[model samples]
Each structure stands twice: as structure tokens, then as C-alpha cells.
Target: MKKFLSALFSLCLVFALVACGSSGGGEASGGESEETFLSIGTGGTGGAWYAIMSAAGAALNSDLNLDVQATGGSIENMKLVTNQSADLGFASPDTAYFAYEGGREFDNANPDLRVVMAGNMMYEYIIVRADSDIHEMEDINGKTVSIGAPGSATDIVGNEVLSSLGVEPAETINLAHSEAATALQEGTVDVMMALSGVPFTAATELSTVEDVRFIPLNQNEIDTVVENNQYWSGGELPAETYEGQNQPIPGINVGSLVIADESASEDDIYNLLNTLLVENHDEWEKGHNLASDFTIEMMETYVENGVVLLPFHPGAEKFFEEQGVTLNK
Candidate 1:
């Protein structure tokens, strides 16, 4: 009787251990699907970056959980991705290059930064009141200017352009795109120096209320800003792009990028891209007007044009390759 009782006790212990293993085991052993949760850092809600990323997050909800966080823009996004605070983010091509190379602004080089895909082509709009004396880029000296949000692509690039053009503002303020537009409308600011896609929403909404015109950067000025920078290009806003504008407004332009941390899983990134770009193409594109630019062809063109300046994430490289797009480094 004693031997039989001891055998029963041992059997019960074995059964408990098996049950614990099955219950506590991870997806690999438990036959459960692994759920990936990620966060995307974007620019202000009123900007194209936020709109495009938010739409993507919504479209990708079925496959994985994504949180689109509004950020200060390019510089902050770079810092967030490098610190693993954000799994993915957006940045100007020049900003991404700067972060990777630790150019001036960055304290140290971030080797873990990788480009997931190309985004929209950003255009600079040096906006001013239509009736103001600031008719040309040279007239900005000693005038109050809103140089975009602090640490954003616009702030950095706007300063660079000002320096290149030898224009000095009396004071430079940092404000979100919409806020700057409001300030301009209220005469609190003399000019709004912004970098965004065509028909920048803030500018558009402001145009409906106040008379505004984009300061056209002459060919020489455009050339000067774009010189020695492969990431920079020239863009022109055709006439009628904004109310009260009768002529094309030409300016400097730069490509935008969607970047991811190097530590992220390649297969997961590939799958996400496949779902966003292929399976949910229609839905994703319909998310925002700018979303239509988020296409594989646009990425390929950016690479061909030397607008995409960073190394592709391994997963992104795999996904693009499957679509017959060769990423040049």
C-alpha cells in the first residue's frame, strides 16, 4: 500500500509540470500567434507625415498593432528610433543622412538606423502676407519668421536656406505648421518658413481666410540650396495651387523617408510592407491625399534619382527585391 501511494504522488507531480509548461510556454511552443506591437513617430497632426502614418497604422491594424505618435518631426523622429522609443518613424532624406553620419547636430553616429521606405517629396514654402513688403527672399532680413517646429526638418533646412541666401531674420520662432499659419494670419509673424508636400494643409486652410503668396526662390537660389546635396531637389508649385497666386512658385525640395530600427525582425517588416503596399493598397492609398505617393514605384524612383540617401533595412530590401526593385545600398 505504501509503494502504490508513493507512485501515485510521483505521477501527479509529472502531470502538474506538463500542464505548467503548456500554459506558460510562448508562441513557439504553445501554438499561439505572436502579436507584434509597434509605435510610429510622426510629425505634427496637421502635417503630411502624421496623416500618412496614421493612415498606415489604421490599415495595418488587422495584421499588427501600431501606434502613431505625433512628434516634433525629422530630428525628434531620428532620436526616437535610435533610442528604441519608436519602432518606426519618418524623416527627411537629408535628416536621415545627417543622423546616420552624426553630422553636427547629432552627438554621436547611429549605426542602427535603417531606411524602411521612401515617402513624399517635401517642398519648401516661404510664405508671407500677400501685401507685406517681403516680396523676395532677400527682404526677410530683420523680419520675424516662423522657422517651422523646433527639431523638425523645416527648422533645420529653413536655417540652412536662410544662411545660404544671406537672409537674417530679426527673430526666429518655432511653431507647428498650423500654428505658424495662424500666427501669419494674425500678423504676429512676418513670414512662415515651411517644408512640406504640395498644397500644405495649413497653408491651404490659411489661404481660404487670408491673402498669402509663396516666395519664389529664383533658379540661382534653388541651385545654391541644392548644390553638393544629392538629397535636395527643385520643386515648383504650379499656378492656382493656392488662391491669389497667379504664377508658379519654384523652391528647393527634398525627399522624405520611412525609417525603422535595425534590430526589428526582417520577416516582420517584410510582412508589414507586403500587407500595407500590396494587400491593402487601395485602402491605404485612400487614407490621405499624400498616401497615394507611398508606392513601391516612388521608392524605386527615389533610389534612381539619388533622393533616398540611407541604407535599406534588411527586411525592406527583401520586400522591395521581391517586387523587382533594386535598392542601391
Candidate 2:
């Protein structure tokens, strides 16, 4: 009787252990379930960021089982990602750096954002009426200028550029790119500073206006501004980007990059980066001219340019590693 009782006890213990193991396996599988949706914060409806992000979002949703939603522009986008309010978003390097360092607009916000990928170099173009006497950057001292909508990255960079050049209180107007172009065409504003990727609709429209001219930022001024702000770089808008505008316009370029929070899972970031860089590259390029700029080589250059302010997520680092590319710390 004692032998039989001991045998029953041992069998019961084995059953309990098997049950616990099965439960643990079930929980592990649940944790590994796929994430199916993501959001991409972009600018106004007609901007380059919006166009590209919208297309990328569609591809991610279809190909990678991700649902990418386009929200407001850069400043708001950074806030979303930093607070974990959104999964993915776009931002300028300047804004990303400021937010990561808790400077400027991000002074009161969290500084734990990380960069996922670099997007493009948006050259700041200052356009004025061709018949107007605004030949140099200083010519718009007291004129009405459309700086850009409030809280937008364009506004932030435009304000800084103007302030750097000692052009204070220049009758700044807060208008979207399209609205600003209309204002310029109708003579409501004398000058407008538009910072965006090439083939921008607003700049292209402003070019078609019979009397508008592209103002060049001198090399000395570009160097001074870049010296003061590490985010600024010197670049030019090719004349071919605009119809009949046959000369390259010298200006300061700001990089647009995709950023996310450090809390995002490695797999999530890996999936996102892989979608943007590899699987969806050709499709993205087909959707917008700006997308043509998205390339692996450019991605490397973006990181090397000091544009990535936050630490790289481990998944992204791994993805780069698998591709045999080393990322700098």
C-alpha cells in the first residue's frame, strides 16, 4: 500500500510540471505576436514628406502588415515619438537634436528619443518677386515674409536663419507652403522662405510666377550659420528643379530623418527600417521625386553627417550589421 501511494504522488508531480511548461510556452508565443499598425507623422497634405510617408505607409501596411498613419509635421511628430504617442514619424535633424538634448522646443519634454533612419536634405530656398529689389538675404529686412506655419519645422529653421542674419521682426507671416505661394503670387507677401526637399510644389509654383526670383545665400553666411548651429549644412537647389530657373540657388540644407523612442522593441524597428531601406525602395522612389533621394549610401552619409542625435535602437543596429555596415557610436 505504501509503495502504491508513493507512485501516485510522483505521477501527480510530473503532471503539474508539464502543465506549467505548457502555460509558459503559450505566454511566450503571445508576447512574440506581430505588431500590425504604425503611424508616420508628416507635414501638410501637399508637402514632400507627406507624399513620401503616405506611399511608404501604404507599402508597409500591405507588405509588412503595418498600418502607417500620417499625422502633423516634424515638431509634433518628434513629440509623438518621444512620448510614445506614435510608433514612427519624421523630423528634421535640427529638431531631432534639440529634442534629444532637451533644447529649444523640447526643453520641457523628455529627451530619450532615438533615430531610426535618415530621409533627405531639405534645402532652404528664399524666393522673391523678380522685379523686386530683394537681391540678397538682407534685402527683406522690413518686408512681409511667409516664414511657414506655426510649430512646423520650416518655421523653426526659418526663424533661426532670419535671426542669425539679424533680420528681426520681418513682418513674418504664418502660412502653409501652398498658402504662402498664393500670397507671393498675389503680392500679399514680398518674400517667402521655404525649406523643403527638391521639386517642392510651392517652390515650383513660385518659379512659374512671371516675376519671382530665387535669392542665394552667400557662402560666407552659410558657413557662419553652420558654425553657430551644427545642424545646418551648405547645399544648393539645382536650377533644373524649377522650370526656367536656370541657375543653382545657394542655401542652407537641413536633413529630414525618421525617429522613434528607445522603448520600441528591436523587432519593430528592424521591420520598419527594413521596409524603408530594402523591400519598399523601388516602390517609394516611384511615388515621389523626393523618394529618389532615399538610398543606402545616403543613409550612411546621413549618420556620418552627425544628423543622428539619439542612440540607435539595437534592432536597427543589428539590421545594419546583417547588411555588413557598421554604425558609429
Best by TM-score: 1
Best of the candidates, lDDT: 1
Report lDDT (Cα) of residue 226, candidate 1: 83
List per-prediction Cα lDDT, in the order shown: 0.86, 0.77
Which window of 10 residues has the lowest lDDT sum in candidate 2?
25-34
Q: Indicate the TM-score of model 2.
A: 0.83
lDDT of 2 by residue, 189-231 (tens): 9987777888777777667765578889898889877888787
Give candidate 2 misplaced runs (Cα > 4 Å): 1-35, 61-72, 209-211
Write model 1 residue lDDT over 1-329, tens digit each, in one string. 99999999999999998877666433534576566777888888778788787788778745477788989999999999999999998999878988998975788989789989888888888999988999899999999999989999989889999998899999999999999999999999999988887766788898889998789999998898888566788888879988898898888877899899899889778978888888887888777667778889999998888876678899999999999998887
What's the true lDDT of residue 295 in model 2?
63
